[model samples]
Target: MEVVNRYLETQASMCFSILYDRYAGKIFGKCLVLLKDEALAQDATQEIFTKIFLNLSGFGEKAKFSTWVYSITYNFCIDFLRRRKKMQSLFDDDTEVERLKDVADDVADEELMEMETAHLRAVLDRLPADDRTVLLMKYQDDMSIKDIASMLDKTESAIKMKLKRAKEKAYRFKQEMFTEAVL
Candidate 1:
């Protein structure tokens, strides 16, 4: 924040460079995960930072600086995917209401977190983009439900439901992969 405040106060390029050095790699990794293509991730990372630079003056203190940056990153990736796929909606919505009714079992966060790294990655890869995205936002990014809700422009309960379904799907994918491997 000192960096942001300094940049805001002096409009100095050096302060911005410090910010870029700190966040660029993390942002790029996130882009690569969401975009699923090295070239497109590279392009998206650059474009996202450009948007950040241009919008620096508009940074409000409502959210943490990291949260604000990630919001921009995630939103940019989602919008890119939407345009590329020509889809009106990027997330699974109420159409799955019937599927969501069953709650006989829930996947514990520790179960997902404790998986071998490669297995975890494989399971995540098998999930639909929307499911993987919500899981990343919740577990990997440590984003709060309120924060995610705001980011996705959904109600808090809606984000919770989405997150629950994502975890369930991830767990199912993990089970199927390992079961098939053993067979």
Candidate 2:
């Protein structure tokens, strides 16, 4: 808050640099995971920082600064993928209602988090963009369901279901990859 206030009050370049130095790597890493291309991620990191600098005055303190930055990063990557793919929905919302009707058994978060890092990375790489993004927002970023729902512009219940589905997909992928490796 102090750093943000100082930056906003003085509009000093050094204050802004402090903010950039703190978040640039994290934002780039997230962009890489979602964009899945080095060149695109690099481009996105620069663009996202530009957006952040322009929108700094609008930061309302409703969420943590880190959360706010991450939401911006997530939105940018999602929009880029949507535009590039020309997809109707990144979250795959068309069948959401139908899928919600059937209450699939939940996958435990501990199970997913406890997997070996290499195996976990393999599983995440195989997931759809929507699934992988949701999982990273939840576990990797330690974001709450409410924060995620707000960021994604979905209801809390919808985010819960999405998280559940992503967890299941990740778990299944982990099993398949390791099983095939063993055979």
Candidate 3:
């Protein structure tokens, strides 16, 4: 936070660069996991950083920097998906959904804990963007529930409920995949 404060005070490129260096990869990975498209993720990463850079002055020190950054990332990705869905509705048919079903059926999770990283990401991708965000924040970023509630602007109980539902959905998806594989 001292570095962040210095960056805010100095408006130095080096300070901003240091912040970017510390967070860009994690932000990009989160975008990729949520967007499920490398090209879109790359674009989204750039957009997220731009948001972070522009909004740095507004940061109130209420949450960890990483949590703040991730909140932006998650919000941007969800908005992007919503926009994409609206656009898709104008042109897309059921083929995309059918293709996703095929992909899901081909991937099985004997045990989620034992699943490979790629498989885990695939399963995560199958979840709703909000659910995926919760899981990522909890497990991938190891953020606490209180921090998540703050980031999401939700009550702690709401965050907990969301997390529980996300986990249950992931487990159900895994079981469905496993059953598909068996058949």
Candidate 4:
């Protein structure tokens, strides 16, 4: 673990290779959740690892090393979503989402949960970065409400309201999608 940090500090290519070996699938699973495109997720996975390598010194081990790395991956995918301003895919099935939480990327569950997730990803992408970020940090990254509020430099109540509003928008988008689908 420390060696991964050292490799980034030294910018050694071989060390980076080792780091990639250690975390590539983990990063890819994260990307798939955020970006939802196998190809772009693959690219985003690589790009995130590259960014981590390039900026590892900035990582001061303030959080669990994994959390810090995940924060970077999450932020990168959100940025990619914002730039694209589109939602072309639903996430992997719910089992996959849970499996993604594990180290092995195993998908033991196979049921798709459309209601559980809605068509809001694109709409969420359309939100201001601040609003979008709060939701991703809360829902996608599973950050505590207090932690998210602190990270956003806001109060806990404010973060809750933002999450509520974000949920409303996602629900609205789901309704819209349903209407379109029915038609």
Candidate 5:
């Protein structure tokens, strides 16, 4: 924090570079999971870093720097998806179900389990950006509900509800996949 303050005060590129070195990988990982494309994630990571640098002066001390950075990352990715109109709902086509079924029938039990995990990932990707973000923040990043609420600027209860719904949605998708496999 002191270093960040100094960087803000001095406008030193080195300080900014240091910050980037410390956080770029984590930011890229978040972008990759949210964007679900390596190229898009890389581009998004660059854009996110730019936004963070430009907005450094506006950062309040209410949240940790990492939290603030992650908030920015999430907002950028969600807005990007919105602008592109690319948020597809899960199980939107019979072709996808057929594809999964075809793969499920040919695989051994171990491979089938792996495929199931992959299918769940695809389902997660298909969820609404906000829902995916909430799930990742809670489970992947292991964020506390309070911190998530603060980061999202929502009430704790609202965050809780969102998390619950996201989990339920994931479960439903998994069940649907399994049912499809069985049939």
Candidate 6:
């Protein structure tokens, strides 16, 4: 996309705006799945876009453009989490906890999946960040293991192992939650 490259080379902020309009929601969706907080994910999205704009000069046609952007978004979020020194990068604070609980309280809420997803996110948050990230890159983003491994600088087999372990943890969390409810 010459236009995209021009947008970068010229520092045409509006051109970048068009690019943002094209993919902000998808990027935000990925961020939400990774961070599990609306606000934090929103912030991460902004940061990712900023990084994209600044680093556009470095990007090449070696891979699909979408894949390149996805790689940037993934790395940006992971860096944010690491820089913050958070035990879990899922939520920035307890407000998200309150918000999710409130949504579950609403009787007419149509998207029960949100609650389930959030619950699953909480379980995911308990996992080591590396394991959680690999699972998200695989399941949430539909990334190939090779792509995911490259993004994370890990081997494909290692990504597979991490994915397997993450799945088991998620399953165990589900079983424990279900058992507690029954008890």
RMSD to truth, every model: 2.3, 3.0, 6.7, 11.0, 7.8, 9.3
lDDT per model, in order? 0.83, 0.85, 0.77, 0.62, 0.75, 0.70
How do these models rank on lDDT, best leading? 2, 1, 3, 5, 6, 4
Evaluate model 4: give its TM-score. 0.54
Ranking the candidates on TM-score from highest down gives 1, 2, 3, 6, 5, 4
Best by lDDT: 2
The count of residue-pair clashes in candidate 5 stands at 0
**Clash counts for all predictions:** 0, 0, 0, 0, 0, 0
- Deviation from native of the Cα of residue 52 in model 4, angstroms: 0.4
> How do the residues 1-183 of candidate 1 rate in per-residue lDDT, one tens digit apiece?
889999989989899889999999989988877877799889998999999988988999888999999999999988888888834566647464434344467879998999998898888767667777788888888999998988998899988888888888777777779967798
Candidate 2, 29: how far from true, in Å? 0.9
Scored by lDDT, model 2 comes in at 0.85
lDDT tens string, model 3, 1-183? 888899889999899889989999999999998888899888999999999988898999987888888889988887787788833432112233222333334222244557667667767978777778888888888889988877777889888767766666676677677657878
lDDT of 5: 0.75
lDDT, model 3: 0.77
Q: Any idea what lDDT model 4 has?
A: 0.62
Q: What's the C-alpha lDDT at position 177 in model 5?
A: 68
Worst 10 residues of 1 by lDDT: 94-103
Can you give the lDDT of residue 26 in candidate 3?
A: 92
lDDT of 4 by residue, 1-183 (tens): 677666756867787777777789878866665565699988888788778876777878767777778777766776677578653231211222211122232211111124444445555545444445665676556788887766545688877766655555555555556657888
TM-score of each: 0.89, 0.89, 0.76, 0.54, 0.70, 0.70
Expressed as tens digits, the lDDT of each residue in 1-183 for candidate 5 is 877898989988889888999989999988988888999999999999999988998999888888888889987887788778775432122132212332223223233234465776777766666778887787666789998888777889888866765665565566676767888
Model 1, global lDDT: 0.83
Q: In candidate 4, which residue ranges exceed 4 Å CA deviation?
A: 8-18, 87-142, 150-154, 162-183
- When 2 and 6 are scored with lDDT, the better candidate is 2
